[model samples]
Target: MAVSPAAAADTDRAGTGDQRPRSRRSGRRRTALAFWAFTGPFLAGLAVFTVVPVAWSAYLSFFDATNTVTPLSEDFVGFGNYTRMLQDQAFLDSLVTFSVFAAFIVPLTFACSLGLALLLDRVRFARAFFRSVFFLPFACSYVVASLVWKMSIFNGVRYGLANAVLDLFGVDDVAWLFNPDPPWYWLVIVSLRLWIQCGFYMILFIAALQQIPAHLYEAAYVDGAKPGRQTFWHITLPQLRATSVAVVMLILIAAYQAFDEFVNLIGNQAYARPPLVYLYYTALGTQQDLGRGSAGALILALIIAIVTLLQGRLLGFGNKEGR
Candidate 1:
């Protein structure tokens, strides 16, 4: 049972197989190192910017941390801030404002985007150009758009585009964003949101509509189904349910987080302050009530979670029943 020294030497040299390149494992190890090298900074930033801030805010929610969020300045309050924020009339009004905004924007954006997608899907020439035209607004900053809407379009003067149109109709100059008695500002806000966002969601619907199997439509057509209404309701609409849910959810979240437009269009008004705007004045404004703001932030996060979950459940987003 004698073994050659040469084989043992070869086994030691190869490690696993004599024919394999010696650098393969090292190359794989280097590849893994490179992957982590590329991704490490992003992960670190997520921890520092996203995770730490969120965790710290949640921690500060239970404390009296006004004027300073540092650990040294915190005084234990144990849900007092949450209770107070829940009772605050301004905060509750902000929630109601968020609800109204969401109700107006979500359905409108969904419908407009889906309609645009359907129309674009039918276009045979210059489709990409048309899509880019519609989607170009998505690239514009919200602040810039809000300012343009406030100052140029609905600036409440005869020189403004809206007022000029009114001038055509022999109508008097009307203050759009300035008048809260009739709340005409809602028109400006909602229209601006729809113009900027509908294109992006239209692209989503376009992608989803393209994902619908042509054979399904063909099969429906073969079964004597009518083309427009019947085919759309039975085939196109049902196929788009997932994308519709996703679009609605994104719109819902965006609507709740509305701040820049509301601030620019309406200013620091009491009428239409959404929760983030209200919470901003609480935490970072002159009040500096970081504890209440943090509590409100957590509460808003919970509301977003509950709302998203409910929408998903109602829409059968995760359901396997039909799909």
Candidate 2:
């Protein structure tokens, strides 16, 4: 028997409904495949270069994976490597030095960078030129910069630029690199760091400063807010708080990871080495003990993680909308 027109229409509607879901599923599958196709190589590279090494390092930390011709032939020592750190006086001293270094450099960089950003924000002339001039140092290699500081600017001789300036004040040339009595080395290290890194953070702050709404400043001005410190405190700082948090965190991480310059300047000297430099010397330095090196790295990672978490908690780092 022939189906009625209404029944035929219902049948066609049922077919169309079934086909819609199937088509949707097929489209979703294609999109997923395309995503994987594009991202697969990057994910593979990340796994090989980053994720695998990190995991292997953690594994090695628990073992006596040192002094063996073959890494795989190493025996397990459990937490022996970790406990070694307690007895390692030089490593302990390095941690102290790094903490002192971070304490000084982080705040100084933040303040100087923010100050530069503020100054540049107000400059109607030569703004870009000044920004480039400041930031150009950041592009220079840290090793080269440190060497310049050691060889040219802060050279222990009387002809060094810093020593010449001191001479103008009748002070004798100071051994900035080798003098550990009053820790004159810190001046070289800290000044070099400020000159190289402050510009990068300044650029970040500048970007954040530019992002602040102009209308808010205009509104503040109409309400008798001056363009000086008043406007800066009320309008600029609060707006830059998030960027400031990020800059501070970056500075902390970078400070903790310091090695190249320290090694290049301090060499094999036992004085004023940071944790990373210490770790390098421990693992590969005359002894070649990979186990202890790996262990120190993991411990440093833990310390950094703890400190970062504490900072995020204290500063409410990730909170965007007010609670």
Candidate 3:
């Protein structure tokens, strides 16, 4: 076989070219498989836990789905559950209570968090220690904290911390949770929330504050701005618009989901019932009306979405241009 050098080179080139494409295809296949392997479980969990439940709840909301979860069993009273919950006195009162709590907690938390963050930002010593100390309460659960507040701090006895303090000024023991005449329970709940929330948000604000360029403050001072109020209003606050909006949105959603503390503190009392507590008693309490509960849940979800979107619109949340 008298093969020319040129023919041998062409055959070699063809063989190399074939192997290259096959190797490339093998690498691509491996990469695709690895990605799926990593993400498949997460996707499955999302479908099972989040998607299926929401769809099922939506389906159940439209039916008289009482006592059983089997789908569409001849008790399909269309929109009956939704309308009934809308007219429910307890549900309506719960909405008002949520509004009141949000009104107080959101601004108060924002202020307290910002204040703590600013103080910590200015500190050059023991900053981490103070931050941890402030953040420690957040690790405690709502139920436990509510019990502490109810039984120890504001227990309406002379031995209680709050009442002990009041006793110093010749005041009698105050019924913090029991007395609805003055609604002193708000102080306990608000303070507990502040203790839990401020540290976390304070950490957030501190991060945001650290990101602010020092030159901005320097330039403000150069432009006849004072250090205390003037610099904060002009340079500090405007720079923190994104963080502020996010904190407000989070606080709003948390307020809407208020349940654990209220339930543990008051035990299904109608005096200051949040929507979740009210819905819980309706769905799982003595009545056990699942249909109305599902409807209420959807309505609450709608309200939350609407309010969040409105905040985003009004405050330019997620708007990069404004930022």
Residue pairs in collision within model 3: none
The number of clashing residue pairs in each candidate reads 0, 0, 0
Model 3 local distance difference test score: 0.86
* Reference-based lDDT, each prediction: 0.86, 0.84, 0.86
List model 1 lDDT by residue over 1-323, tens digit each: 13333443444456544335766555445555665677679779999999999999998998898798874544888989999999999998989888888889999999999999999999999998999999999999999999899999999889999999999999999989877878998999999999999999999999989988999989988899988999999889988877787788889888877999998888667888999988888999699989899999999999989988888888877554237
TM-score winner between candidates 1 and 3: 3
lDDT of 2 by residue, 1-323 (tens): 14443454455555556567777555555655655677678789989998888788878777777664236634877888899976788888888988999998999999999998888888999988999999999999889998899899989999999999999999988998897988888888888899999999999999998898899999998999898889888788888888888899999888988887788888757788898888888778577788888889888889889999999999888777223
RMSD of 1: 7.9
TM-score for every candidate vs. truth?
Answer: 0.86, 0.88, 0.89
TM-score: model 3 vs. ground truth: 0.89
lDDT of 3 by residue, 135-213 (tens): 8888988888998998999898889999999999999889998788899988988998898878999999999999999
- Candidate 1 regions with alpha-carbon error over 4 angstroms: 1-35, 71-74, 319-322
